[model samples]
Target: MRFATYELDGSVHAGVVSDDGLHTLPSGTTVLDLVRAGLPAALTAGSAALTGPPTPLDLARLLPPLTPPTIRDFVAFEEHVEGVVASVSGGSGVPAEWYEAPTFYFTNPYALIGAHDDVPVPPGSRLLDFELEVAAVVGRDGSSLTPAQASDAIFGYTVFNDWSARDLQRREMKVGLGPAKGKDSATTLGPWLVTADELAPFHDEDGFLALDMRVSVNGVEVGHDLLSNMGWPFAELVSYASRGTWVRAGDVLGSGTCGNGGCLAELWGRRGEQDPPALRPGDVVEMTVEGIGTIRNRVVPGIELPPVRAARSRTRAR
Candidate 1:
């Protein structure tokens, strides 16, 4: 079943999506509560206790499925990496180590936005871009689990749009560290979350979900691909993340960006600059996953701040 967190009369509540609208979940206060209570099982049981009229989705405000306890986004697609790398000067093919394991970076959990929310067009980011991906929300707590074991820990899936400030990202990446301000500003997740059982049919022989992923800006298609194109499966990504660490309930692990042009950085490498330009203020971005529905957001101007300056080195002689 599809689950969502919505606002009604200024109060947020967890509910199950239905043909008519959202049915309030009596067993939980928020989607996180339902997740902690055992995901699909708890969701089903709580939905059964629902009474009163269902709220039509159009009339309610949708929020992110839940404010995740932690967010880990992985680079699990090779083609995406290759294309992004090829776009930059002095860059070559995908790094050899990328093929060895699924790598991820922890992003700011506080910077999340829900579907239809206005995303600030990050200041100084001329290359603003959106990454179309899918994310799995953790259902149970586990550590060092095998891929098979990790599979059971997954609660469900949701459409994830990893909004990027490419200019900031490039500047920071040149320092040999991970993305910080470049990505920490904002990330979008939702429309609604789909429980694992509901997506079982979409799984392929290799265990990867064969879901179609697409992204459009201002109603123009920018990227499109299949989730099955990932080099590592979501279960493996979860298991790898659990290595020497614990993955708790409410933790979200993203499938990274999909292969066949899942981001504008890739498109730039293939098609160059003019054809489909970078995201700008007022541009609407819509991302869709075959089963997960769509999330449409309008880009808003970012809040300005003091200029950044280079820090003085205290350790070196003047």
Candidate 2:
């Protein structure tokens, strides 16, 4: 089932997507609310709601899939990792050791924007980029789950735009705390989330359920990829990620930046340090993942926010 959060007449409502329309979930309920209600039952109900809603998707502009409790993104794609390592170290291949486990970081869940929202052009980021990815919604809170059990613990999947400020990330990651400030500004998500069962058949190869990924700026195609090409599968990411920690319901685990070229860094060859294209005001970027759907964000440049370096340090020191 596809579930979403939306505002009509200035009120936020949750509901299921149906051929007929969107059936309002409830005034006080959210996707998280259903998670707390019991994942199994929630799954069943979400399934029923998909094609039964009385409201139309056209009447509702999409909202981010969930108001997650916490959002964590993991480096689960080997292709992206290899590309990054090669680009960073000037090597052609990844060390065998790099693929041993998953590397993840937390993002502010409160900062997420919805589909069709305008992404603010953060100050000082001459280089802005997009990462097309799939994020898993956690369900059935638990700790140290083995890979075998990770499947049932998942709630669903959604398309994610891990909006980035490439220049800042490069500078701050050198300190070892981030990709934080560079990453924290904004992360766009939504339309709605597709429950696991609804997307399970996609697990097969040939990607009969193929999700075509596309990105455009001012309606120009820039980055594109396919879901089946991912070096690491969704199940592997979740299982590897949950090995030693607790991931609760409403938690969104990102699939990391898709293949290197799928984001601005590689798209414009930012690593080679020549000159990568930087977006200007009125530049709109749209990301669409097959099956899941599309998210369009317009970029309106903001007066530079001063790189946020010392401010972050002062905040850290306090």
Candidate 3:
């Protein structure tokens, strides 16, 4: 079943998506609340339990399915790693350690926006980019889980756009620390969340989702790939995320960027040119994942701030 958080008649609501319309859950019940109750319980307590008439889907404004407790984005695609490494450093291979395990970075959960929201080009940024990816929402709490267990803990999936400021990211990572301010600006999720069971037809023998993924800018197509192309599957990414740590309900795990033009950097690296242009104000980006849905966002101007002051030189003690 598909679940979504939407606004109707000036009020926000969580509901189950059906062909007829959106069946609103009880007042104050959110997608996160349903996820926390476990998928089985949610399915059993489906829209049949609701009393009110269905809300016309077209009349409601969609919001991010839920405010994730945390967002962990993993670079699980080998081709993406190779292309990005080449783009930044002219390097030709993936890091050796990257092959040893699934790696990820924490991104700001508070910076999330809904599927149709406008994204501001982060302040001081000239080269803006969009990453086409998919994310899994955790349904239960678990620690030190095995890959199989992590698979079972998943609640649903959503289209994710890890919006980036390439210039800011390049400068920050030079100090060996972040994609911090470069990335914290915006992350998009939604349209709706499709339950794990709903995607059973797409699952491969190794439990990887063979869903087709695609991204387009304005009206032109830029990148396309299969979700199963990742070096590590979603289950392993979640399992590694829980290594000596915890993954709880409402936490989101992203599949990172797909390869073959997932982002402009990868394209530039492959073609050795900065053609196709970086995102500009008024540019619209749409990412679609088969089985889940599409998320389209437009870029807008950002508020600029003064640059940080340079550090002063230290005096030597005689």
**Candidate achieving the largest lDDT:** 3
lDDT of 2 by residue, 139-173 (tens): 77877776557777887888888888877777776
Candidate 3 regions with alpha-carbon error over 4 angstroms: 49-52, 316-318
For lDDT, candidate 1 versus 2, the one ahead is: 1
Worst 10 residues of 3 by lDDT: 44-53
lDDT of 2: 0.73
Worst 10 residues of 1 by lDDT: 43-52
lDDT of 1 by residue, 112-155 (tens): 89998999978777778889989999999999999999999999
The number of clashing residue pairs in model 1 is: 0
Candidate ordering by lDDT (highest first)? 3, 1, 2
In model 1, how large is the Cα lDDT of residue 199?
96
Per-prediction CA RMSD (Å): 1.7, 3.9, 1.5
lDDT of each: 0.86, 0.73, 0.89
Residues 195-261 of candidate 3 have per-residue lDDT tens digits of 9999989999988899999999988999999999998888888899999989999999999999988
TM-score of each: 0.95, 0.86, 0.96
Question: Candidate 3 at residue 237, lDDT?
Answer: 87
Model 1 quality (TM-score) = 0.95
